[model samples]
Target: MKRIFVLLAGLCCISCLYPQAPATEAILEAFENRSRQHLLHENEAYALTSFSPAYLFDTLLPAAEARYKKHPDTWLQVHLLRLRANAASNHRNLNNNIGIRPESVTLTEEAIRLCHLEGNDLLLAETYFDMAELFNLYARHEEYITMLTKAFEIADREGHDYFPGILLYHKLAGMCKAAFHINSYRESIHYGNRALAMLGALKRPPDLHTEIFVYDLVGFSYKMLHQADSSIFYYRRINELLKGRDTSTVFYKLWSAIANGNIGENLSAQGNAIAADPLLEQWERAGIGFGDSANISLARKAQAANYFRKGEYDKALQCWLFVFEWSKKEKHFTNAAAAAEGIASVYRRKGHVDDAFFYFRQSQVYNDSLTAFNNRSGLQAVQAKVKLENLQQSLANSKALLKVEKRSKQFLLAGIVLLAVIATLLYNRQRLKAQNRLQRLAQQKREAELDARKTKEEIENFVRHIKEKNDLIDSLRDKLSSDTALKARQDILEGLSEYTLITDHEWEQFKTGFAKTYPSFFPAMAARLNQVTPAEERLATLIFLGFNNLQIANTLGIGRESVTRARYRLKQRLSLSKTEELEELIAKW
Candidate 1:
């Protein structure tokens, strides 16, 4: 009877707390109805590439901020608001530059900080999903995958809900795409299938757009893995989905062209260029009509690949040259490099040794430029991490100082109270003591600065050691390649490949050393070049260590022209004047 009464009391308390469940449900339903109205008109309200959509953020952000201030502890509410702000900012910025935007990163970091305070795992998972998007914008594939894994784990633990599942599906699909870009075929396929599984697990079927992207990612991943039949199956599935859809819509035509082009590319890859011709032509026509020069160029490249596969060297050479020129003209270094490489390979096949060497050197220059660009991006991430750490440390110091100050004030107040109750003689003595304490604190700060410089020097030495190890590995590789009689040449080559690429362990060590030595450098550099890459950062590191162009070129195993070109490209990315030296900037950093 006591247990029953206890249960009854608990139920009564719950009933008292939530007495208006029915009314609450009605209000929620009304809000959801209004939200659906907005979702339905998203194209008009939130365009993919338009500043006009920014008004939505301008209108919604103030309201969201106002509400967030009222319920500061509700992380989910604030995160959703932040997501809207980020999306709106991205929509506006992507119209001008498709690379990472400053505002998006700022908003994502804010959301991440809020996620820590959320306490609820599910809400925190959503914030992770938002962070993955920001990482994706910066082309940080590994971090993107890591954040996605966190979100997936929490969502799985919490038991899948429809809303979170929607995000998971999209994120899974995006991870597949990113993995493909980074050339991790197995991981791409894994995430692609995960997305497909997510679609199956959804209570409501995915909409056409989601289905299209999922199919495309899966199909592309399969194509890369050389699973022709499996790839063809998914591409055909996309065709089935697009069946009877309005062909007039830009998205519809775009996907249609992509799907058909992919099918042709698959056929061509299988040594049937003749069979691929019709589809390739169709895609090219559609791309040209749509004013998508990039896609048109891609179609041409595929056609060139088809010709090369068929041993039509002249035709292949013509197409490759056209692609190289087009890509170079557009400053698409990656595409240009690919084309130049292709041209060089064709020249070698035709026994034009000099031409082959020239184009090969040109390809190297472009490749090195791309490498430097990627390195710069890594430097920026390192900088951001260091900056965040410094900010946290500063915050900790401020809190500590505030606590001390508060305690001192409290003691002063207490002393005043006691003085009023007893005597006034001690008040002047307390004021003098506080002034003396302030002077000591100032001296301590100065000592701390000197200690920090010492630590910085130690970290610089460690980073220098890391660089020496890298240089040694490069020298070893060159020696091995030169020594044709080396018995374990292939084994050594495989081992070198494994070790030379930056593993997570090595990256963590580098980050730690960088953070210690260049605590303020990365943030300043990142602010100047938001889209910097890892290769550029590596170059900058060497530059900072007093390596000149020739030395950097030798260290990186690229030609001096490549080094010079990389510097030029870095200058452009940094928006520096021609007179402003990159080395000078690195020195400042």
Candidate 2:
């Protein structure tokens, strides 16, 4: 009896060491319950503060992994992998790491694979959304959009009412707004509206903050598109929603001020100065109270516009001068350009040609600086895009090779089973074909990369040449001023300006070269061409080509001040925002 008790005790120890894995349903239910709890409180603050990385890593992840190891089920493993990735991502984000962790991406990809294998559309959609978030964290915007689009398509196909569809729409709208391009604003509005529609369709009380966010996005997009009436309508809708809310809260006050400010600006743009003034004043006061420089400047700009429209030139001049100095001090080149232009306009209307000319030149200088900055940013974006595309191509090639190897193995097995004598021959032929295909793919990738590199180098060289030519012209101007006979100096200077003037034939040649370098430039400008004069178009092209204000003046054979005036006029014709970089818009187009 004692010997039997000893054996039972030993058996009990063994059972303790190898406990049974929880059922798959129980594991899933636990995950779902925790996820729901986290997501429910997620919007209380940004940065996923509701979800604890420590808890996920220390408790949930171990539990999930243990179950996954024991069961080895596709769904179980997918959930386990997803949980691991989420934990890693959360940890990185909490640490303020701007980049994504490679492990997180790998784990997410594995989860995606398992989801596909299990034929689980909802799981696949969720995995795609997580991948999109990962790409977003890495600032791989194109990849982020691609992933989001795939998830959205999957959600639509599966007819998932809320889990991902609404979230997808909301995210896409925000992404479009962040793109900072005019066309993207239209897309933002489109997605934002759809999100609102979906929210309305829900049976339960919708998320108020989400509704407000979508409304604000839609309003801001319309404002960027210069649809002032529509923008005002949406802003008013926001105000209507905020009417009964607690005005003492920061959130309510902020949104209320934003809506009022936007409405005022739109009204002013529509030439309703009387109606805009009170709102502008209110916005200005709110800006001052909040100490928000951007809002303050915007309000002041709108006020200046109203003053100018009301024939209050002195008041307009005062406001513009203040904004100009402040913007210059703050190094806000776009605002500086707008304020300088405003000052120039006020001076011109006051019959102060010299003052107007001086301010116009100032505006032009600021504009040139803005253009240079935008060009640099655009070049960086292009380089990044090329790198991303190459990476994507490489990944595609790797996937293809994997698929080929998988198929080859399957074929080889079939051959061995059906005809053992021919198995070796089939394997040799398949191996040779795979090798040939790999070589062809490698060659294509190399050629494509070479072409991209050559194109980029050529564009850079073209820009460098333009800069060198401008430098030469500047040197000539200085030499002529210093060495010319005093009596003939004025004549020489005038003659030089005339000599530098590009003739029609020269312009045609220049345009041809430009088209070769940037084939889409003219086509992108086609819609706006009718809005500007031929001279304005030429100035814009030179600016887009990276010409400084002095270079543009020399090329056009005009006074430097005249070039500045022309730029100011061009900006007005474009109807761009006070802070919108002209070159940035052209580059995006």
Candidate 3:
């Protein structure tokens, strides 16, 4: 409630301080032309590339601000506010720009409120989504969630608006990916699956490559969780999707490769080095030297295993040596230790007893370190559980105490009220008794004094009512809703109907508006991002943002089998190929 008050107070201040400028019909018409074109095609792949759209949207920032000053009118202010907020929303994707400050959170929130005030539901959803992203970047998960929920509410209210639904679904899936990395895999799938389902229901060639992203994340999470069959399923789905698409996308190709690499790893782990190479080779070829430190290590390990299986001690040792040196440089302790153990094994095979012992001891050291890390994590988990239990008990006790206090206050108030009534009756009784001994004037005087006392008591009772309300809020750690007319507003739905969510036609217009504005730009942007990251990039992005492989896969509308393979690839591109982690690689990327 306090949070609500603060949010409301801030909004109230903004509304009061920033008066809307009176805009002219001419300027209003001009803006409508520009906005209609921009919003209509905003999601098109080439919208940003087209000069007219770009000029009207991105490059026209200065023009909008200039127009605001030039006209200082109602239509212009509305246009400026909407465009400015939207421009910030758009600029969020360009953090690669290094020095640009995206629109402030306060500005975004205010703009969203303004849109609501103006009944621009689509605009409100769009602005809120941006705010959610801002919260995510700042590591404020709860805030991100609140904003996301609000965005969904507005978008859903828009009804059948493709853009709002799609964008909201996209963000939810992305949030799921982030959740997976944080070890909140279930939630990851929850969001991912919803997003995938939404995508599956849409037309092909895609409105946005969101389905691909969710699938990649799902697949990667599955791989990390070691669900080999499920991982393969998602990877295979990706493969099918990539038949006509460029297999050269750093991310997409990497997953196909990782699918192969992991299959090889699984084989090699079971002592079938000969069978693993073909898969590993495919992964390597797909790599294209894209700064994949982890893949290089994994490839080397696989090669070492193959040589070891073939009884080529020297070759096996060489591969292991490379893995050892590189894993150490990359700080991949587990892989480094594995390489050390393999090196030691190779030395033993070569009859180098002392050298074998040295590598064996090194392996032991890493093993001990890993044991310690696991122990520490386990200890923390146990402590956290205990602390949570204790907190829950404490909260229960606090609630009990609050109830007792409330009852005590009620008793005291009841006693005081009874005394006031009794005293009034006694005083009136005394006045009647005096009627036989006093004049009419004196009785009238007593009546006047009694009326004054009654008025004072009423004023005191009102003050007490206010105080009690304040106390109740204080006890709840919330705001005192102290509105005397609150009895008339007992239903929350009565006032904030705008916050209610319902899916329908307005949502379709939103999608159409953005698509018309961008014109294939969604796919184009996907293509551009893919050039560096690929379709498989979603795995890393999803995981980095958080999501478990299963959830990720579900969101992508594929089996977890495919997600596993994608993770293998994501690990390589993100330079975490050798790690069993679902998080570090994402952070590195």
lDDT for each residue of candidate 2 in 1-589, tens digit (9 for 90 to 100): 0111101001101112212223323434433332423222222211121123343456556876776667666765666777677666555343335455678778877777665554566666666766666655545555555666677777788665425233444565545544433235666677677666666554453456657777877887887688999999988998998988899997787778878988988998898988888898888888888888777887787788889999999988888887888898888887799899999999999999999999999999999998886676566556655754664566566667778998999998888777866666688878888999999999999997786667656656655765676677768778888998876877876776665556778777666666665777777777865655668668878888778788788777788898888877777777888898787877665
Candidate 1 residues 1-589, lDDT tens each?
0111101001101112221334333322322232323212221222221222233244434444555566544443544445553664454444334555667656655655554543445445555665665566556676667666766777788666423345456667777877666656678788888888776776557568867887887887798688877888888889898899898998888888888888998999887889898888888888899999888888888788888888988888988898899999897777788788889989999999999999999999999987876676457546645654664476456657778998999999999888796646666878888889999999999887787787677657755665676678678878888985666877886675454334446555665666666787777778788776878776776678787675566555566688899888888887789788878888898
Model 3 lDDT tens row, 435-539: 766777788889867866665565445335534543443343222244424655444323322221212353343334434433453454354344554345444
Worst 10 residues of 1 by lDDT: 1-10
- Candidate 2 residue 346 C-alpha distance from true site, Å: 2.9
lDDT of every model, 2 decimals: 0.66, 0.67, 0.56
Q: Evaluate model 3: give its TM-score.
A: 0.42
Name every residue pair that clashes in candidate 2.
none
Winner on TM-score between 1 and 2 is 2
Per candidate, the number of residue pairs that clash is 19, 0, 76
Native-to-model Cα distance after best TM-score fit, residue 391 in candidate 3, in Å: 25
Candidate 1 has an lDDT of: 0.66
